[model samples]
Target: MKKEESFSLEKGEANQELDDDGKPTRTGTWLSASAHIITAVVGSGVLSLTWCLAQLGWVVGTSFLVVFAAISWFTCILLTDCYRSHVTGSRNYNYMQAVKTNLGGRKYKLCGIAQYGTLVGVSIGYTITSSISMAAIKRSNCFYKYGHDKECHTLNTPYMLIFAFIEIIMSQIPDFHKLSFISIIATIMSFAYSSIGIGLSIAKIAGGAYPRTSIGLPTRTDISNMDKMWNIFCAIGDMAFAYSFCAVLIEIQDTLKSSPPENKVMKTATTIGISATTSFYMLCGLLGYAAFGNDAPGNYLTGFGYYDPFWLVDIGNLCIVIHLLGAYQVMVQPFFAFVENWSHRKWPESGIVNKDYTVGCFRINSFRLVWRSTYVILATLVAMIFPFFNEFLALIGSMTFWPLTVYFPIEMYISQVKLRRNSFTWIWLKALSFVCLLVSLLAAVGSIRGLVVSVETFKVFRSMS
Candidate 1:
C-alpha cells in the first residue's frame, strides 16, 4: 500500500518539495493570482466586445457583462471551496486531478476534455487573432499608399507560422506555476491595448467623429424577431468569452499563498480580477459602441481603417500581437501541464519532469520540441485555413463555459463538501446547476448557428486571394 501510494503521488504531482519549516511552501500572493486571472479573462475577447454591444445594443450588452461577472465570481467561490475540501492542505498540480479526486474518473474524463479543448481553442484563437492583427497593420499601410484596391502581401499565414515558432520555443518551460511572470506581462499588455482602445474611442467622440447610434440591428419590422434573439444569445456568448477564467483557475491556484489555497485569498483575488476586468470590458465596449455607433466593425481597432492618426491605430494592433503572445502562453501552459503529466506517467523510467535548476532542462528537449511544436503548428494551420475569429471565440465559450465555469465547480462542490441533503440551499444549488446546463445547450445552438453564418460569410483559404 505504501509503495503504491508513493507511485500514485509521484504521477499526480511532480513538485512536492517542503520548505525549511517542514511545511508545503506556497509561492503566490492574492495579487499575483488576481493578475493571472485578469490576464486570462481580459484578452482578445475584449477586441470583439464592441461587436457584442453592437449585437445587443448598449443597455442589454452592458447588463449581460455585469451578470456574467457576478456568475463568474460565484463560480470562483465554489472552486475555492472544492480546493479546500479535496486538497485539504495537500498539493494539487492541475484541475483534472482536483476533479478526479472529488468526483472520480468518469467525471474527470469529461472535465479533462472540456478543459483541454477550451485551452486549445483559446490558444488557436490567439494565434489567428495575432496574425490577423499584424496583417491589419500591413493592410492599413497598403491602403494608405495604394488607395482602395491595395494588393497587400502580408497575409495571416506567414505571421501565424512566425508566431508558432516563437510560442513553441517559449513553451519549452516545464512548470506551469513558473508562468507567473509571463502572466503579469500578459495582464499589463491587456491593459495597454484596452486603455489605448478606450483612449482612441474617447478621442473620436470628443473630436465630433462619433455619432450616437446603434449598429448591427435592423430597423425594418419585416425582419424576424428570431434573428434579433439569436444575435442577443451570440452577444451573451461573447460576454461569456470575455469573462471566462475558470479553465485556468486551478493552474492559477497552484501559486496561492495559503496551503490548500484558502477561500479568503481566492475570493479576494477573484473579486479583484473580475471587478477590474468587468470595468475594462464595459469601458471599451461602451466607448467603442459610442464612437462607431451602428457602423462598428467586428474588431474595433482593425476596423478603424487607415485614415488619419493611422500610426496610433497601427501601434494599437501591434500591442494586441504582443498581448496575444503573452496570453497564448498563459492559456497554453496549463495544457502543457496536462501533456507533460501524461507523458511522464507513460515513461516513468525517463526524467520527464520539471528540472527547474538544470540549464539543459529549459532547452528544447526532443519530447517538448516535437509535441509542443506540433501542437502550435496544428493550431496555426487551422487558424490560417478557417479564419473566423469572433464566431470561434463564441463557439469555444459556449462549449466550455457551462461545464468548466458553472457546472463542474458546483457539482464537484456538492459531491465533495458536506452539504445537507434535501435542504433548501442544496436544492437551490442543484436547480441552478441544471439551469446552467440548459443555458449551455442554448449557447451551443447559438454557437453552431453563428459558426455556420461566419463560415459562409468569411473567405476560406483567404490567403489564396
Candidate 2:
C-alpha cells in the first residue's frame, strides 16, 4: 500500500482516519471511540467524589450529580453534532483544534496550554491523593501486623516515594490500547471496592455498629453565609470536573470511523459509563455520610475502624492507585507526543525514550532528560506544597474542566453552524446548547471561587503549622 493508504489503515484500526491536514475523519467503531472518554471520566475523581458530595449533604450532592449528569449528556450530544458538522473530514481536529478552526488561533493555543497545565495539575493531585490513601493503608496494615513499632516512629516518606515511583514508571508506557485493559480492571475494582465499603457501612449502621442521626438539613443559619457560598461553589467545581471529559467525545468519535452504528454504540457506552460513575459516587457519598454522620472524614475509609475486617478498602486503594497510573498515562501521553513533535530536532520520530529518573533506569538524551526531570520536580513540588487533594482537584476543575466541558462544546456547536448551515436538524439543540453554556459558566465560576478559598485555607493552615 502507498503511504497514505498505510496511514489510513493504521488510523482506521485506531479509530482515526486522517484527512490531508492530519485531522481525523469519522471512521472508527463506537467502542474504540469511547475508550478514552471512559478513562478520562473515571479517574481519582470518583474515589473522592463521594467525599465531595458528602460535604454538601447527601440530598444536595445526589441532586447535583443528577443535574450534572443530565447536563453532561446534553453537552456531549451538542459536541458530537458540532464535530460531525464542522470538522467532519479532518483527523487533525480535537477540542482545541475545533476552537482554533472557529475561534481565533491564539485563543485555541491558550486553551490548549491551559488544558495541558490542568492535566499536569490533575496528575499531581491524583498522585498525592493516591499516595496518602496508600500510606493510610500501609500504616494501618503495619500497625495491624507490627502493633505500632515505637522505634519506627518516622514519617513513611519511603513508602510514598516508592508508590510514586511505581506510578511514574507505569505512566511512561506509550500505548493506550494496552492501557485500556488495565483501566477496565481498575473500573471493576473501583466498583467492587465502593460496593463492599457501602455494604459494610450499611450493615454496620443496621447493627448499630455506628450511630446514625439526622442533624437537620443544612439551613442557611446552620452554615454561615460564607460557608454556604463556599460549599455551593465547591459543588459546582466538582460537577465541572466530574463532567469535563465530555469534550473528549469528539476525539473518540473520530477514532470510530464515524460510522452511524458506531455513533449510537458510543452514545450508549458513554451514557452507561457516566451512569455507573454517578451511581457509584452517589452510593458511596450517601452511605459514607450516613455511616459517620457529620464527623465523617473526607475519605470514605475514615468511617471504618482499623479492625473493621473490610479488606476491600485496602484492595480498593491499591486498585485506585493502579487506575490513576493508567489515567495519568492517558492524560499525559498527548502532552508527551506534543513535546516530541515540537522538539523533533533533539529527539527522533521513533523509539522516543520513556524512562523517568525518578522511577526507572534508562538511557535518556540530554534534552529529554532535562524536560522529564523538570516535569517531575515541578509536579512534585506543587503537589507537596498544596498537599490538600480536594483543593488541587478544585483548581484543576475550575481552570481546565470548565473549558473542556462547557466552553469547547459551545464553540464546536457554533463552528458547526458556520460549516454545515442547515445541513442537520436538531430543533432543541440550540436551546440545549445555551443551557450547557450557562451551567458550565456557573460551574466554572463556582469552582474558581472554591479553589481560591481552598488555597487561602491551605495558606492559613500552613502558617498555623
- Show model 1 residue runs off by greater than 4 Å: 1-26, 86-88, 147-154, 210-227, 259-262, 351-364, 457-460, 463-465
> How high is the CA lDDT of each candidate model?
0.76, 0.59
Q: List model 2 lDDT by residue over 40-112, tens digit each.
A: 7766665556556545666666777787777777667666654432345443335566566667788788878
Worst 10 residues of 2 by lDDT: 150-159
What is the lDDT, from 0 to 100, of the residue 428 in candidate 2? 51
Runs in model 2 deviating more than 4 A are 1-35, 82-88, 142-160, 175-178, 209-225, 251-265, 305-307, 345-370, 418-465
Error of 2 at 231 (Å): 3.3
Q: Which candidate number maximizes TM-score?
A: 1
TM-score of each: 0.88, 0.76
Instruction: Give the C-alpha miss distance for residue 52 in model 1, angstroms.
Output: 0.7
- lDDT for 91 in candidate 2 is 39
lDDT of 2 at 326: 62
Scanning candidate 1 in windows of ten residues, the lowest lDDT window is 12-21
